[model samples]
Target: MSGNTRGITREKALQLTMRKCEWCGTAIVYKNAQAVYCSSRCRVYAHRARNNPFAALRNEKRWVLWDTNKRPIMPSGAPASSTDPSTWSMGHVVNGHLNIGFVLGDGFACIDLDHCLVGGRPNEAASEFLKSYPKHYIEISPSGDGLHIWGTADEGPGTRRIENGLSVERYTTGRYITVTGRVFQPGNLLPL
Candidate 1:
């Protein structure tokens, strides 16, 4: 059927190019063809509902302050609680805190893929595992050689698995994971 238009009509071709607002039920006619929402308000609602992965996590009291060494600490450089909100803050970034850590637990989990990146790109093993979760929130680790996959988990215990000589650890509680806010791939609406 190369270069053939056997039963295709011109009207059908025009209909294929028609666009609609992703948020509202209005027709879209913006100069940018990639535009999804009709306005900023619609865009915000859509982001909070689905695109923004950190929206729900911010509501919980599982935030903690971390130092540059990736250790949980208070603003005064004291040891912080990984299970308590004693040294935790509602905001991820603080005046004295160099980094922020999210206390793992409360229906949230992080799958740590250690040493998965090589020369700023995901290695063969990491790429294969990442393909299973393309829509989840993934961030580059502090060492720049690993990845952290954040998502909801069950109420049970966490597990550790080994695959392709990489350490894959999953935890729901009793631990605090560092938050680098560095996004991986684009085309995702997730706000860093």
Candidate 2:
């Protein structure tokens, strides 16, 4: 009965049984007769991951490209119309360079694209890649049709190796790949 004891008494264990997931508040039950979570889903939700603000921003369509003053920058060179989905692309400011590229996938109408390497519009080369894929990720090529999409080996179809003169690491699921032509490495990415 003492609080310092390692194990709980049967009565206390029954009293402490969780009724819901601690993270998402989903219903839970001790099916194994000694378990805390009803299912593995609740356990993973409770302890597997941390909240990410960038991911939250990606989910919400409120993310925008603005200057330090919060002034929205018009996407220059964007197709006047959505006539050819292939022609539409996004730009991001990367390393002070405006490396514009088109986005691929649904629900990305409001994602801002700036230069990924220099912090401006993507150059003509990167923009061409965007025009080709129009999806979340793509490959960079010598000619057109090179969209360098950054994704992990687990979630998507194909995997390509990218070298930026830095050590490459193993890929994992749920990593954030920005349309700005940069892959947000889990630990390397700045905390939101």
Estimate TM-scores for all models: 0.65, 0.23
| Model 2: number of backbone collisions | 37
Q: Which residues of candidate 1, in runs, are more than 4 Å off?
A: 1-49, 92-97, 186-192
The clash tally of candidate 1 reads 0
* Model 1 lDDT per residue over 116-145, tens place: 899989888889888877766788888888
Q: Which numbered prediction scores highest in TM-score against the true structure?
A: 1
TM-score of 1: 0.65
Which candidate number maximizes lDDT?
Answer: 1
User: Pairs clashing in candidate 1?
Assistant: none
Q: Please give the CA lDDT of all the candidate structures.
A: 0.70, 0.33
> Residue 95 of candidate 2: its Cα lDDT?
22
- Give per-residue lDDT, candidate 2, residue 60: 31
- Estimate, for each residue in 42-95, the C-alpha lDDT of model 2 and write its tens digit: 454334233431342233322223333333333443322222333332332222
